[model samples]
Target: MNLSLFDQFMSPTMMGIPLILLAMSIPLLLFPTPTNRWLNNRLTTLQTWFLSVFTKQLMLPLNIKGHKWALSLASLMVFLITMNLLGLLPYTFTPTTQLSMNLGLAVPFWLATVLIGLRNQPTAALGHLLPEGTPTLLIPILIIIETISLFIRPLALGVRLTANLTAGHLLIQLISTAVFVLLPLMPVTAIFTAMVLFLLTLLEIAVAMIQAYVFILLLSLYLQENT
Candidate 1:
């Protein structure tokens, strides 16, 4: 019998190759491609419309330099949303649930934004470490604290995504297992539990989408600060 509840989070392999790569690629395939014709299919049209609206909203606060990231950020947003939703399916693995995977994504983007700030406006970027009108005695302590907070951004990004996804999945699993075990012993209680599980599943679906959005949103906010 499988004793560990965390086994489901393990990366699966096939023929000595990891399936996480396959899972990541699957979302790209699901996107509808644009046609050469002036008029496109409903699906393609809908996709275009959604993307335009999302891009507009996301880039609203950004300046011209920051707008350059519109396509990259929007693409990442879709990719993440698709992956998170796909992982909700039974028997599918969520790469985002892995702390390492989340960190891999968070660190590079976070670093890029920081670098942009440092390169474009060195004074402004370093100025963030110590605010204006600070007392002389507390200046050093505040700078140290601010520096620590600045470095913590990427770690916060990764942990937030990983912890939210992991918790949701674990809760679903525990509730599902309870449903199965209680069905034979207490049919009434099991029915109520199953109903709760159904509601939780819907909530998880929303969580998956929201977490993806939150991840990108925070990155954009960080970019906004630097740009």
Candidate 2:
């Protein structure tokens, strides 16, 4: 069987990032000024809470750079999230579900934090990576563990987003097909299928918001800690 166009687009890593970039860049290009400070404020609050959670209940940065960075990041995050949710519609592809696409979006921020730490405070960066407050004998173990965990953040972020979208889409497809198959035998099954599709559509909306929040929260936490 020939693969559909949807499958081809969904398979590409480069497919999703451009859409997200376009979604993000449009507003910035159209409205250069901060016409709506409400969004900015909301994003800042999210960043604060997110950082606090990851930093063992420690305070997070509310500095200019932090807010500015979050503002920029939030725009991208919103776009990616919208695109992901939109894909749940009939005949649409979820781009973030691709490893290449999510990694492209995630790695830049991950590397940016690294650069920020290295440029501003090399010692802190080293400490952040190697860590301290461990027994001498456990230092090596801690280093290996922390290093693996640190590197895995971006991979985990990408995989989680991709996997969630993939699973959701697959469920929708499977449920629809199952309903279609059983519809010939039972009309009530068709009705139930329709209900499921409706419910799943709503759930997809929540999934979009949740995926966006998770991605942004993790990114903010990473930046807050590294910087």
Per-model TM against the reference: 0.97, 0.73
Report how far off residue 176 is in candidate 1 (Å): 0.6
lDDT of each: 0.92, 0.70
RMSD of 2: 6.4
Per-residue CA lDDT of model 2 for 25-52, tens digit only, reads 4434432343445555555566556544
Model 1 vs. true fold: TM: 0.97
Model 1 residue 47 lDDT? Answer: 90
Which regions of candidate 1 deviate over 4 angstroms? 1-3
In angstroms, how far off is 60's CA in candidate 2? 7.1
